[model samples]
Target: MDMKQAATFIIALLCAMCASAQTETPDTISSRQLDEVVVNVEKPQVRAEDGVMIVDLPGIVKDKPVDNILEALGYLPGVMNNNGMIWLTGASNVTIILNGELANMPLQNLYQLLYTTPVDRLKNVEVMYSAPAKYHVNGAVINVVLKTPTPLDGLQGQVRAGYNQAHYGSYGGVLAATYAIKDWSFDLNYGLTSNKSWSREETWSNHLYDGKRTIIEDDMRRIGHNWSNTIFASASWKTLKLTYNGQIVSDSKSWNLSSGTLGNYTNAYNMLSPVGYHNIALRYAAPFGMTVGGDYTCYSENRSQSLFKDTDYLLGSENRQDINRWHVYVDQEHQFGKWQLNYGAEYQHSKDHSSQHYGIVGMADNPDFDDILNEDVASFYVGTQRSFDWGLTFNASAKGEYYHNKYQHNWNFIPQLGATYYKTPKSIFQLNFDAQRIYPSYWELHGGTSHINDYSTIIGNPKLQPYIQYDAQFNYILRQKYVATLYFQYGDKAMVQLPYQSPDALNLIYQTINMNYERVAGLNLNAPFGVGYIWNATATANIMNRRAKANHFHDISFDNSKWIFYGSLTNSFKFSQNCPVSVSIDFSYISPSLQGIADLSAIWKIDAGVKWLFGKKRCCELDLKEDDIFNKWSPTMTISHAGQDYRMKVHDMTRNFKLTFIWRFNGFKPKESNSIDTSRFGTGK
Candidate 1:
């Protein structure tokens, strides 16, 4: 269906559901719950406080066909899991934390940890549009709170195994155990995954070089296999806690084949990455209200790439990086009646040893460098939160940061403010403002080059600078079930990767550069409704306008703007209490959007899953899921502005089917972990 029709249909469906809900009487509602015993206790599924939206995760996942924390996050309103990346609607980026602490690991490793964590361990999830300084994160944040083990809980454990089929086959398993006695708790989790993945990309580029327009076409197919292992262990005694998180991922057999005007080329890639993180934290409650924490992380990766043309080796490159980072923080909080005050100071240092070597057989330029980089960041912040008797709650914080590096040194001041008005139980209003600074990836600041073909190369820019982002949001919650949000975001000196053709040479360079600025204003709506006790539905829509401008982009200056729309509808149905079976169907659509200088086409997908509970006390669960049933998730990107013409289509293996089985022994609890700044630890590919 077209965009207009699809939107209309979604609105009609939601209206029809709302109308049906209105027709139900008290007696009908009571009859709907007759199958399940009611305990006469009512708990709000969603609430807003301290500029954060709290969601009762257990209630939402009770009937969903999700076995892990990562999958369960997809069910949260306004949150989307697009190809394993979790994103908040209308936000540029999102940070995910466990138990209010960020995990100090790579995004992939953090995803692995969440994927292996059982959903039963989640207590609630906090969604913050503008996180405070104490959180040590920027923009949108999703805090995944874990349930602490209680006395007499004893030993609890769970095991899960999953198999997936797409263009290839993949399997994984997880084992987690937790023990608690009195005030001491211990937790350990280990997971292993072996995955084979495949994807294909078709590119058509029209290059204007030497006053002649040349059209280049490339069809590349990528296939890879990787093994990932993750382990997390923690011990907590009273208010003191110690934890370790480690992961190792090896991709030994990854290759790509391209056949087109390039005349057939083969690229072989191999990588081995291992990360180790250690953290210790102690907190004293009551009058002191002090918290002190420190963490150290060691990360290393080795990667090699080889390119050949018709069995003739053309180029070979080797890249390596070893990084050591340490962080320390101290926070103090004091409570005075309905008002609370907090202050914190944190310092972080990272040392990176990196080297790149290139061997070229032809006349191409060789870009190689070996360098050691050191960075230090220190920040101090003070904040206050207060709740008035008039149902008004507010929080504000300002942070000052001092950053130092070999290239540059600077200081930044960030401010955050949020207020919520909930004078009535049926209606709530919230407003938040936040500002943060974003730095370039470490590798991006290193002038290194990697070749895709003889004509196309990816290069880094050493002069890249950090940027600042500002966000403001206003929210309205009706009856605690419907949410409407209006938000505006601006990125100063935004960084974007763009393809530039050399006017003097037959070369196409892909580089990440600082754009002039980017601005986004959007409105988002989320409505959750129930059709009695058997069916539950959530509908969300986001409409936004994006504008980006750049003055000097490799001899071209342009201003681009576009309006984007994204919507999703998710429904869950339970067969019956006796059968213990549930089914879920979800649909999402994204209208034409603009990214950098490229225009993206519209895309949509439908996903469905089935879950069954068996064994005594429903200790065993079997879940089957199919995603992208129509195989229409990837969007075509076209660039036709500023004397540039390019069209690219990706036919990836996004459509997949998977089956998972979960077995719980006794009960399972989770431990808290700290987050690391591994986002810049890679080769910046």
Candidate 2:
């Protein structure tokens, strides 16, 4: 039988088993305490605190089909996890933190860590629309808080193994352990994965060369395999912590077959990347309500990529980056009756030594270079929070920064404001405004060239500049179960990757450039409800309008705008409390969207999953999930403006079946670690 048929059969069998095991009935209880018994209700699963939204993760995942922390995060009101990338509704990008601090690792490593971690260790999640200056992050933020280890908690550990079937079969495993005694705690975690993936793309370009229309069609198929090893270790004594996070990825190989009107060719792309991160931090609480802390981070990564075409060597590239960064801060707090005051100052410095080399068939087209970049930043901020008898609370802060880098120097002043009104138990309202600046990737700012095929190439521009972003959001909570949000965002001097066909040659070049501005205004609605004790559901929808403008793009300039809509609905069903079986089905849809000068088509997907808990103490868990059941997640792209005409379609292996088994011992939990600046670690894509 085929894979889809097998998945259907397995789901049917599990349903039958659950049905057969629901023979026991719940026992009735009788209470005779003055005719009527008073029972207090539990705390709400979601609430507003300060300038953030707090979600009770444990309460939301209880008796649900959630298997890990990553899965649980998808249930948040405006959060979506699309193929391991987390995005907030109507927001550009998001930053994820652990225990109110950023993790010093790559995005892929962080996702893997969350996938292997047990849900029992999560205390709560804080969603911030506009992060405060203290967090040192722009845009939206998702803070994952873990439970603290108590004294005498001897040893805790967990082991997990998983297999996935897509166009190919892949497997992996994880092991984690933690120990706490007296005033000391230690944590160690290791994971290994052997992954295989596949994708296909077809491009049709109508080139207008020398006033002649030429139709170029190229079809490419990509297949890849890789092995990754991740390790994390930490030891903490009171307020001092030493942490190490490392990842080694080897055997990274990919083969791309391109065949069409152009010619028949095979491209072999091979890469090996290994990264290491180390951090040491110390925090002390001194007299007169003062706290001081400092952190030192050392990070390094080496990546090499080689491309070959049909047994003929084409190009080879090596990229390396070594970074040493440090930060020191001092904070003071004061209490003035019903009001609280907080002030802090921080300074940070980073030294980066980055180098790149290219070995190309045509040596004159590519060059090798090395450079060192030094950056220093200093900031100071003060904030005040107060709650009045009128059921209103507000916080405001302003920060001034002096930033100096090798290429440029600037001074910026930013202000943040937030307020919440929670007079009634059933209604809550909040408003926030924040601003920040974003920098370009390290590799994107380098002048380099890489060839994809004979007629396609990627070029980097060293003149890329940083951009500023402003955000405003208003949120309303109704009955503590429904949420409505209205938001606006504006980006100045935005940067985006655009494709350009050389007017004089037969080459198509892709490059990143700066845009004049971009604007987005949207409204989002979320509702979560339950029907009896068998079914629970959450639905979310977002409708927005996007506008982007550029004054100088190659030989043409244009303004583009579009309206988009996105929606999702997730349903969970429990057979019976005694059966220990649950099922879930999810659906999502995205309307036509706009990116730069391209217009995208609509896309939709359906997914399903089943979970079973068995063995003594319910320590064993088996989960089966099938994503993109109909295999319609990929969207088509078209660009036809300013003499640029192109069309492309992608047929990737988005549909896959995954099975995971987990075994826990002695209540396994892991500690949180420090963070570093890894946003500019690797080469550009």
Candidate 3:
């Protein structure tokens, strides 16, 4: 019992089974209607104008409450969350949503359950940085909205506990419940996490005849247990309204790794990844504001690794791997009053099964590996949107897919267009264009033989081909809170990986091939001081060139050229009337490239945070955050083949602190200062 004493005895036995299974509240009560229905806080969405683009999480955590999940996407606007590690622009294929349901989990367990739920148990978190044919057309889309209780409730509850420490240490506890009677709504969430990690790896290799340097040390210990139970059973009498959103998640991760190595490198590398997910969602609504939605998800992962080598290691291996994914999706939308009618259809079947069980740990020769990969995909999508009368707006979308496995099975289509106009109203103007189709995931198709990365020898590519991107975004919304966006992207046949020097393998190897073209263009700037000071700035300069047709793929290279800057500043205050004070500052820069025979480098990072909101009895506010503030440690050297070279100066992951505490306990009824929605009587604009 030492995983923080079994995670504090399973969080004091789940808060004593939610305080003796509740069942006692209503002796003439309702917590005053939970403070008068939380005052709506503006977050009920429906702007069909053109499918995809939602920013609502209880209207951005009005008075705070949406623990983790990156604090409801760190309160929108170009979104970026570290620690909870949720990146959009830094792009790593985003996707996470709740309510409209979606969770492909695993960015290392959603960065430990987004710091274990906060922000008042959320009720919104939707972001689609492009890529929307109603959800799954892949690449860049995030949604995590959880909160639904009240619509005439029937037992609702929320509880949370947290603790964080930089280098290594974290504690948590959370319990969310809602059981809406009539229209159905049953959600139960329970979680527990304990973590510790310290990493350090430095390796330098320049060979022609053995010249090596290695330093590796990773002490990690983690214990995570999470569970989500959702059952949003819905229904409506006459004009239809059928809903059923089921949920199932049992996440478990138990890891322990301790290592140290050097020179002829006597080595060490250990890994453990155990994951799970199963979700289902279905929706159908009508009453003039037609709507239809469908969702089906299944994700599974199991990874195990144990490697120890020395004696100038030749080829020693011990591994176990398994990765699975299954998805089925459908969508449709309709609205009257602005003209909009969108459509959708999705079908996915994936089975990327890999099994590697080998033994021969001392001199080299290790065999006994099995690989199985069977993936099938079928998809469809359509869209339309219009609004004319000066402030003109028009949009269109399309997506089609079909693949049987082994090397694609035909069928593919992706397209999109956008337009917006406003002669006045903060001087508005916008236009976007898209035509994308990138498919090559499943760890790029079979990922194994990864000597804890660095021994390199990573493999994937069941033929690899399906890359075609053309993106464009232009914006200008000054005055009413400044904003400027300009971007352009182009890609063709791009999906490359080549780091060669394998005279029959033995270190000095890197594989993944397919390349024909590459292109990118960027610019962005946004500003706002309205809601108590807000600001964002970005400048990305890009130009990449790649070619292949003559000998060894006609060489062409460009490594992220110049300009990549970001700045964020937020301020809020209201000391009295129930406390409030928030301060934040973040910045990053990396503009100095040219490596691999063309030396030259540059990097920068910063972070700061402060919060104090303790008022209204069942109190709150207790936060302190410090991230890489001028503690930038750097070391990176690169070279693609040509005598092979590698050196990574590892350090940084220092200067870290997060001590947070927030408490709330109140049951319903306690807000009302002009509420509207008597089921909306006579409508007809």
Candidate 4:
């Protein structure tokens, strides 16, 4: 039988089993209330389930002056924030999701969302070392689950304001409200922010040819002004849900090359981008723990940039891009005695259009490039979970996808397997194996070029190929307080971006290309501890080795390898048992690391904060934070490849102080609400 026919047959058989396994209702039932009891104990911050690690953000960040989710992530285990980017402890490829579904936005937009959303709206964050087939993702995954509004009738809302001072002043405001009655509910969240910042960068390059060397230096200053707005709304009735999310951003920048001898290269530009997504989902539960659901999602993005240099007629450029995507999916699950089954299918289609215009003084007319791309993807998978009598649980699955582009087509299959053994109530062991494929983004495949200055430029490659990898991990947990993990991965025909210099002149070019192979192996450790009733702390460390081979640059081909280390510690203190104030400090360090041909130097940082709660009901909060208090957060880069020596340093607004105030009001007690997971749609860069 064909795959589709087989899937249909299995689903029908499972439905029959679910019907037959249902038990008859009892004729008589009685209920009684027992005496109330309360237990007081410290709640754990980290938990392990099957093969995934769950971090309770509310329990960990309660005493910290964390306004947003990004600030709270610094205290989580195995997570680091380098500038505005997130880097996992031992993984090269990682994806972030919202409430178990794909975020469907760019990196900058994701950062903005994290900064604007308050931490009180978050419940838990799940970290998966290897993604399952049901998720439709390639590598490691981080899922952020938000707190659903209480289902009780009445109204609740919060108002917040904050300000920060660095190179300049920045301010923001947020408002959120929720209302529920009977079986219907509604929620709204809106935020606005504005900022002004100054930054500086220094670069030095040495070119070698004909047994001689020439040096060049470029130092630049940038001044920027930006404003952004975000809005989200949701409505639910019984088993049906609908959500809408949108963002609008505007940015303007002015820059000058102050110490370069390249004839006063100066530029200014303005950009505007808007993004939106709409999702609808339905879920139903039947007899014998059988559940079914489906989701339809729509996403779109529009961006425009205008550029000018020296004079409007000397050098100018304009670019615009528009994207639209639609996704549909259906899933089913059934639970019987010691066995569970899950299956799903999904389809996605996307259309992207981009255009650019370039103008120079000597050109007769402006040069322009325009292109359109279409892509369609279909996927299906079946997974099963079972618990054996010998204190062992296992899960296994197989999946495949048919991918088609305007000019090419392919089919691929992957397998996933995991097993766990419960040695005792306090100790456990787990092993996991996964395989997946990674594809490049739309702009990367369009072969677009954008100029940086007179002698430097960046370009994309249209001939890039997709790559696949196989990963394996082993983990051990003790008393739910300590953890150790070991992992390894190997990839063939991988890809990486590198900087290249022209052999005859002092020109620099950045481009991406496919490599022969790459391998990574790593280990991670974590522990949480407490001293008496006033002190608590958590520590994490990671060590890894990486190697890349068969990389080519001009006439030279070489291999690169390195060892990297990372560590972090977070401490919290309470002055007394009756006080409503607390203090927290966080410290972290990263040793030298290698990214392809470039070598990065070590970096360290320290942050401290204090929080105070007031009012009869503790409805008001005041937070004071000092970021990079020691002023030791600078990162440096060095490269020595293809007879070129280069180094670059950036000093931006990495240090700052901020104060915030929040007032909350509620007319009814909050109750937990139930929401369906729609995380498999709107996947993007």
User: What does candidate 2's lDDT look like per residue over 33-85, in tens digits?
Assistant: 43266464656767887777888767666655566688788878888878767
Candidate 1's error at 551, in angstroms? 1.0
For candidate 4, the clash count comes to: 1
The local distance difference test score of model 1 is: 0.82
lDDT of 1 by residue, 134-205 (tens): 877766788998878766778898999999998999999999888889889998889999989999999988
Q: Cα RMSDs of all predictions?
A: 6.1, 3.6, 24.7, 13.3
- Backbone collision tally, model 2: 0
Name the regions of candidate 2 deviating beyond 4 angstroms: 1-43, 63-65, 272-289, 360-362, 668-678
Write down the TM-score for model 4: 0.85
- Cα lDDT tens digits for candidate 3, 1-685: 6789997985565444345434234334455467466342422322212324444444433433334556557545555555455655423245565444343443443444444445555654544445456655444456665555655656655555666665666565665555565555555555655555554544445444334433233322222333343333344433233433333333433222223343233234333333344434445555555445444444444444434333333343444434444554556678668877777665656565555554444424333446666777677878778878877777677878777777567777777766667756556666666666666655545444444333444554456666776666665555434445566665676555644445443454554555555555555564534332232222222222222221233243333333334445433323222234444555555444442232334656676665554445334555566666665534344544444454545454555666665554454212321000011000000
Point out the higher-scoring one by lDDT: 1 or 4: 1
> What number of clashing residue pairs does each candidate have, in the order they appear?
8, 0, 23, 1
Each candidate structure's TM-score, on Cα atoms with residue i matched to residue i, is 0.92, 0.91, 0.29, 0.85
Inter-residue clash pairs, candidate 2? none
Residue 633 lDDT, candidate 2, scale 0-100: 91
| lDDT of candidates 1 onward, in order | 0.82, 0.77, 0.48, 0.68
lDDT of 2 at 448: 67
Model 1 TM-score relative to the real fold: 0.92
